[model samples]
Target: MPGPDLLSSQGLRLDGRRPNELRRIKCKLGVFTQPDGSAYLEQGNTKVLAAVYGPHQAAKSKSSTDGVVVNCQYSTATFSTGERKNRPRGDRKSQEMSMHLRQALTAAIKTELYPRSQIDIYVEVLQADGGAYCAGVNAATLALIDAGIPLRAYACACSASMAWRAGQPEPLLDVGHVEEAAGGVVLTVAALPNTGSIALLEMSHRLHMDYFDVVLSRAMQGCRDIEIILDRAVRDHLAEGWTKQDIVTI
Candidate 1:
């Protein structure tokens, strides 16, 4: 159970969104020329930049004969949040986030095709209002595509939270910072919506079993919606004749 005042009398969230609405997502691919692929994405106030390098030779210690190695590094800028603390990239939290990122991305990548190779993905959070991990996953997916990596399907991520409106349990989609801070159950999901598969699922706080399905379903729906948005962005990028070497913006 969360704080009772999560929703307004009219059933709107703190950011004036309905229970099933996602924040506006704006993204651009090929934002940089140095990396093989790069992208910048914004989900409301949350912004992330991702860069992907190689399918090049892997170091002996980290190389795998059976498949390509996917290495990820997740970091938050010093000023990303209001706290403005000097957060080290090798800290425990960043390491965990990096592992989670690698898991979600490896699920989409066709690693078997590039055996004995290595791919590096670096994600940096420029701003975080909530759902920063999800944003990082989304941005990294685009960067991988820009790098011309093969994937089983698009990797999309979204989050959900539980709240009540009109005496009925309502699942909030694409939770923002305010809702997250309200002390409710927050569920984050990363999925391949086109393939009907989930890559990762995480939750903060306990939720009733009865409401669990509903929340999960809502998060999946959000992933599906995000997939559409990302697909459109890809199409538009192609239509604009974007090349990985070209400097472009959208």
Candidate 2:
């Protein structure tokens, strides 16, 4: 079988985004009432939900003397992808994703302030068009913010892939599932965009040294873009609640 055609004749990706363009990211915070904080995010076709619970007492084995313990869980619904998955979390893939999610969130969280305590983060993918890890990180960040947790900066993530256009290498930003299925090298980066610092980086395959810089740069740019959108959503969420309260009467 032939592989997917990732790039179009016009140099656009299969999903109609330009090589440097990211898929639309829409998100909302406080989506769940049960959790201390929660958020839902949609990046193109991929959808994810994140909930945070804690700053509570930590188990003796897990407690840290100088910082809070960060626990993360990543799962994909059985119907999230084209293939029906029998389970969500027991698989090795989910396990690896869980560690990566922890890496990203831990960097943004102010763990030192809550010593001997712990924070629980749970992320679930409702749809997986591509870049599930990146979407999960973004959602988790929003959930953390909704929980009123302090952090050095907002953590965000994005994915990039390389494609050829007229014999010239072009780095694609925020790859979709179709591009992902093409078996190309994919670079995923999680970063504290406001601080211009990376928290974690992963790749599907080895990439040539010459192309690595460009691809990683594209992914970083995508992260910054995602941060801007998330920041706006947070501001809007705050404004909505503020508008309802007549502060003058209080």
Candidate 3:
């Protein structure tokens, strides 16, 4: 059976926002200095951290002549989800996610610029409310920027869901786990928002072809919104110049 009506008669969602509304986004770049680059991002209750390393020579087996090799690893913290994860990495699920992350990021990076070199990106999910993959992608994008990697555009990802309530078809932006678990159709998209190019798209459940356009558009909008938030965070981090404050006396 369908879950509780996701949209009330007042046109507000369970989180008390309009259908196109997105949750609050908080992000920080260069969160870890030990890595070449790193960033932390939080979207609603979902939190993710990403670290980037290299642009250096690839290991013996992974080297390529035509383009740079991008190695990616995705792992979830043991306590990230409601149910604890026993391992942080090497699991089948993490392995698959790592592949997907590599695929998505390769599309945005200008790999040919660093032929025979390599870039390593590692993403860790600190909290998983929903849209963990999307959050990871966004965080990794920022970390790449902090690492000074050239890219075609800012890569962003977001999720959308269809909530038909009161005979109206409403699209939810940036779905949370509660909304995702409701059995509604979910459409996830990773895109270069500035260029309006889609890098990855996946759909869960079923929705009429007519609704595809609406849901896809909503997800794209969410991606664009997320890009703005990330851009602002990057700028803020640069402006702040070391979050730690210490008195200086001459």
Candidate 4:
């Protein structure tokens, strides 16, 4: 079976976006007071929250003298998806997500600046329509910035899928849950959009070798577009947070 249609007659996705357009992104930093840093991110229907704690000492076993140790925990709310009733974390799927989150974040942080220290990041998915992991990575990057951590550049993630439009292969950006469940090949990329260096690349299914480059490029371009949104959010956050209070003499 070719499966359900992922595109409209007008060349829009199920979510009504152009082939290369990303879902709406909105983010805020310092969403919590307890954690060293916190952030919330929304990408279409997917929502993620991230908290960062510690540049504190690492356990001797996990400590590294060459760079900072990065630890990540990934969890999804029980009601995050349509299906309910299950554990949220410590499961096989969560464990795998944790490792992938760590990989993308470690690449952005200037770990060399904090040798023998540890930075712990936790990500929670509040809702998922698609690209939960990508939202997680972007949220963690903002949390790191709010924590005053040094970074070579911001880390951003995006996904791409192929759809048939006018009988031509059209690369879709920011695959949603529907497209993801459609059995299409989904290519996910995490990268430093400024430097255009990939931190992580993953594919859910096989794609033709001939069309592989086009799909990958679309995902990377999505990452870059996401970076622009995130950077603006950070700057706006700084402006609001660092405002100077006027003092008057009585």
Candidate 1 residue-pair clash tally: 0
lDDT of 4 by residue, 7-106 (tens): 7889888878899999999999988877888899999999999999989999899999999999999999999999993999999989999999999999
TM-score per prediction, in order, is 0.97, 0.94, 0.93, 0.94
What range of 10 consecutive residues in model 4 has the weakest lDDT sum?
241-250
Tell me the TM-score of model 2: 0.94
Q: Which ranges of candidate 3 are over 4 A from the true structure?
A: 1-4, 241-250
* True-structure lDDT of candidate 1: 0.93
Model 1, span 19-118: residue lDDT tens: 8999999999998888999999999999999999999999999999999999999999989987885874888888999999999999999999999999
As a TM-score, model 4 comes out at 0.94
Q: Is candidate 1 or candidate 3 better by TM-score?
A: 1
Clashes of 2: 0
Candidate 1 versus the native: TM-score?
A: 0.97
Task: Name the top lDDT candidate.
Answer: 1
Score residue 107 of candidate 2 by CA lDDT.
96
Residues forming the 10-long window of minimal summed lDDT in candidate 1: 241-250
Off by over 4 Å in 2: 1-5, 242-250
Query: Residue 35 in model 4: shift from native, Å?
Result: 0.7
